[model samples]
Target: MTTMTAPAQRFREFRMPDVGEGLTEAEILKWYVAVGDTVTDGQVICEVETAKAAVELPIPYDGVVSEIRFGEGTTVDVGTPIIVVDAGGDGAAGSADSGGSAGSAGVAASEPPAVQTPAPEAPPAEPKRQAVLVGYGVAPSATTRRPRKQAAPDVPAPDVPTADVPTAAVPAQAAELNGHDRAAAVDRPLAKPPVRKLAKELGIDLATVVPTGPNGVVTREDIRAAAAPPAALPPVTAAPEPLAATAGARETRIPIKGVRKATAQAMVTSAFTAPHVTEFVTFDITRTMKLVQELKEDRAFTGVRVGPLLLVAKALLVALKRHPEANAAWDEAAQEIVHKSYVNLGIAAATPRGLIVPNIKDAHDKTLPELAAALGELVATARDGKTSPAAMQGGTVTITNVGVFGVDTGTPILNPGESAILAFGAIKLQPWVHKGKVKPRQVTTLALSFDHRLVDGELGSRVLADVAAILEQPKRLLTWG
Candidate 1:
């Protein structure tokens, strides 16, 4: 009797998705799984640092991992297959389970229940795949790198008269290679593309440099060391002296790829694209400060964050409602102003990665305590670098509390698509006239920067004035909101 063999398991590849936004590439920061590990659908497989932020990528299918196409620290382009999994759809495992049940039924009459049956003829198949949710299935494309160009063939030089040849030339070549072609051919060391370019610019030959990198690859330091003074070279005559060890800077260059790169590009685009006009106002926030303290004692704010920032955010939303034009975005391609009805209030939080402006969704709809809770969660998530891309998108307005750093205030740049940004300055006790009497009051400065194309000076001034009024009065929020 012939036993049937099971069909082969099918593998599915997972390609890198854009995460969010149209970011083209990301560097694999860490891998959470290895070959042969069982992974479920929606499990985080790896963390990648993109031009925007560090994001954790979730595998969309359930199966045993088969391969990791790229190692950690490798930058992979969007749509590239980074992992493979065995998603067995064919009834390989089911067939083995049927055979095992049959074998168990035949042996139960004579043997003990604990006795083991004979193993199946084939290996267990991988788990079946589930529906992917985060990103699409693996893209069909080749994963090979482009081939390097071939060096041109060397041409044999025409014979020269031995009588006229210099003796020094012939001896130098023999000495350099020890009269062996193999020694000459093995002189060139391996290096990454960037290191090779650096070596070329510094006039250092890789052939002479020693390798210090993994697998005998030459590094930037190796090139610099090869170019350094030989310890025996005599001092040079009065031209610009070579940069000595003391003069040479020991610099550490961090790649500008992730958050820093994204922030820089966004700031540059916003600064140049929008004609920014900043208006500052110094006001007494003593009433706002007193309200924050009173709210902290109230049961409504129990275990919830109550602070000046929470009040500032609420005031901004109220001001936006008053001056709707200031809370709009410019659609350059459509040549129209997009006025948003809802507020996605963004609060700028400084993180290890960089500045990320994550917003509270529908913040205008939330009560003061609810807004405080949302703000607290947003700040905590941002600090932990757990803020999702969706949370950072579609901000109608932003508040950057520069006061935390003791900064007076700054001409804050608008977020790429948003029309306005409010910079809240440090609050300090200063002598001020209140009801015609000079008394010490809590004073702070507010700088509002807005796009002139969407919000005119009058509209911007109204929004700023409204926010200042609410802070100074503390009771205007009830009337305005």
Candidate 2:
């Protein structure tokens, strides 16, 4: 008699790998894929947080994702499997056609695979080695999903902004969970949570329906266009008073603490104490933008973002190399200029907490892609209010990205402790006298400010001109480097 036999199967589980930072646990900040989703080996599946910063975690196996062992914001430890995959198994998950759900690592009827744990440090027994997401090492462990939490009986849950809640949050079973209301966090016309935050900062309302991205996601372009729409009324003859008049009747209060408070005091001291002189130099950076497009396609820079700002940064570091005096700090007590040989390039990022100029340490030593990755992590940390005090110090030069708001250009104040600050304005298609002919080109205005006590017009002008020249000829960065 012929006996029925089962099909061969293999299961893969991705554990939290050794980040090499001697970290005990990490917070799962984001999950890119869900269970039952198809993923290849090395695709970024989740982001975890160590003590230093958060990092993306990659999948170790190539197969149909069967189980996502952890949810967002869950803290996991090393050697714990965060995901389970049916590697080398058929495409379908647990289907009758996909080998009947029993893989090599499949949980046996006697001893099931243990879920991820931070305690009881058992030696990790894992499957074959695979890559971790953020250039980390190997990991192996099974996964178990934890039960949902019931918000304690008394404490009230803060009102979640309507703009913040996505379709993903509205589960099919929200109705069964105690009459919880899904009223939009924002009453504006229609916008995402982030978009609503942007509008609020710029003092805009969503009722002005102009969409930039898919599903009405407003882009920076949309915001700028809204502020200064074309085909509008004629220019006003009279200009408003500087800084505008303060409101006498209405009262507003904001707490003086945290990063905002620190930034405020420093700006006040720097503006009053430092004798600042600012200059402007516009450039046509069509070539630099083209280079950025090419770099984005390169595999080495795949996970690392390469943007226009990165090139601008490179230009600054290069200029500083040529002229070291530009990378000095004004010394009041010492009565001497403190020149720094190393450039800790600081990028002033405006977060909800206000302006914080966190810098990249030894920025001049790193390659372009490495700089881009550092910048990405720095900005993300600043926005989340996780940036520490140490990262904000020891900066020799600063770059404030006013162009992000589509601002043409502005004479920005000097950041405390820095002698020179460069301002990169908006990039737009504008009529330019190119090759002695009027043609549309991606153009922008660049502004440079320096401490007049140290830098004369010749030095400041040279620094600004050098930056503009590189943007005009991006290939110069390679030759010059």
Candidate 3:
């Protein structure tokens, strides 16, 4: 019998698009669809964790999922084909058509070749348009690949064994080791720059630390675990107590990934690169405290968090308006000072993931109530680990309310690319001279740290003084604004 067969089916492949600004890779956190499931264009098919934040990737086309190339928890590089789908027709329809055509053609035409139907090819894959992700734009074209650097010519290998060779001779290795004297731990353990810094800060040797991350990379948690003190020292009279059960079991290794890793790198860069100059001022903020209490009782602030931090943030914004130089960054490469006209006020939130500073866009334009609402939302999102990386960038100034932790004050480090960070200390009812009378007043300490290159002592002091003045007189916002 002669048979006519349905045409070969065409499948569309969806490659992993860059989810963040120039992020090369992302770990597939979860997949929302399975093989055989139908998906529409602009529907989120999977969630990926990039170095900056967790992001969801939407599928580009209407189709039945034919294959999943990667599993959850797998790290995928950008431009790699991640999924395949049959866009033209269902498999069952194709199969049924093929069978019917084959049987009919075989019976009808024995002499002539059976007529074959050509399956319509799926249209050229279009770049999936994604929703606005923070810090990432909609990929112009999803199908395009990043241009790769040209390969260097191969050189003949040295005749000696290089395994034991100390990497200290290499300048890059020296820089990574944190100094010229230390040798690179290339042969021992692999860790990211932030993890290496954490290890260095904790005085832990990565060579001795156990790696628990993918591909045997030492994580921050591993460094912390290694730095953890033994449960108890062995008694002098006793044989070293067989390793205590609590030694390793008691410690928790939380991998330094995502937000925490990014924060660490930024902090290190800010601390070392900028010449920081901190100035402190202890002030009486009774009026601001009173205003906070009044706001909480107001119907407008119902269900919203009203606290001293709100006033502190507002005060900082006002101060920035008065001393614009305080809201600037030193551009070393450009050798120019970038004085921001508008303030993207950043609020430092200590979230479960780590400390993240998500800024309120254009805090200078936001009213007190709007600023309060933005602050509350920013904190809530941060605590939920849902703050997008976009919310964390473009900060002109930052306020860290360490006062919530009951600390008096701290020399807060400047956030990278920003000139100043204001540290708000705890407000306590202390005896203070109010109108030349010693009485119990709401007092707090403020510490302002700035990049000395862009902000001089006079300018930093003026900004701190202005914030203190605003806090001292809550009515100044109405007049200054």
Work out the TM-score per prediction: 0.69, 0.50, 0.66
Ranking by lDDT: 1, 3, 2
| Candidate 1 lDDT, 238-356, residue by residue in tens | 12323333366454335566777889999999999999999999999999999999999999999988899999999998898887767788998999999888999999999998988
**Which candidate has the top score in lDDT?**
1
Superior by lDDT: candidate 1 or candidate 2: 1
Kindly report the root-mean-square deviation of model 2 from the true structure over all alpha carbons. Answer: 17.6
Q: Note each model's CA RMSD in angstroms.
A: 14.0, 17.6, 12.3
The global C-alpha lDDT for each of the candidates, from Candidate 1 onward, is: 0.77, 0.70, 0.73
Better of 1 and 3 by TM-score: 1
C-alpha RMSD in Å of predicted model 1 compared with the true structure: 14.0
**Better-scoring candidate (lDDT), 2 or 3:** 3
Between 1 and 2, whose TM-score is larger? 1
**TM-score between candidate 1 and the true structure:** 0.69
Q: Write down the worst ten-residue block by lDDT for model 1.
A: 143-152
How far is 29's C-alpha from truth in model 3 (Å)? 2.5
For candidate 2, the per-residue lDDT at 376 reads: 90
**Local accuracy of candidate 3 as per-residue lDDT tens digits, 1-481:** 4443433334666777666665666778889999999998788888877766676777767789988989997876566567877777444356556646556544445634332321223323434546533322233342323221111123221321233332222313322343323433335467666678788888888889878875466776578667766652222213333334346554343445666787898889999999999999998999998898899998878778888898888888888888777777787888999888999988888876578888999999987788889889998888876777688888888889998889999999888888888899998999999888999998999999988899899988898998999999999988986
User: For model 2, what is the alpha-carbon lDDT of residue 238?
Assistant: 23
Off by over 4 Å in 3: 1-9, 88-254, 299-303
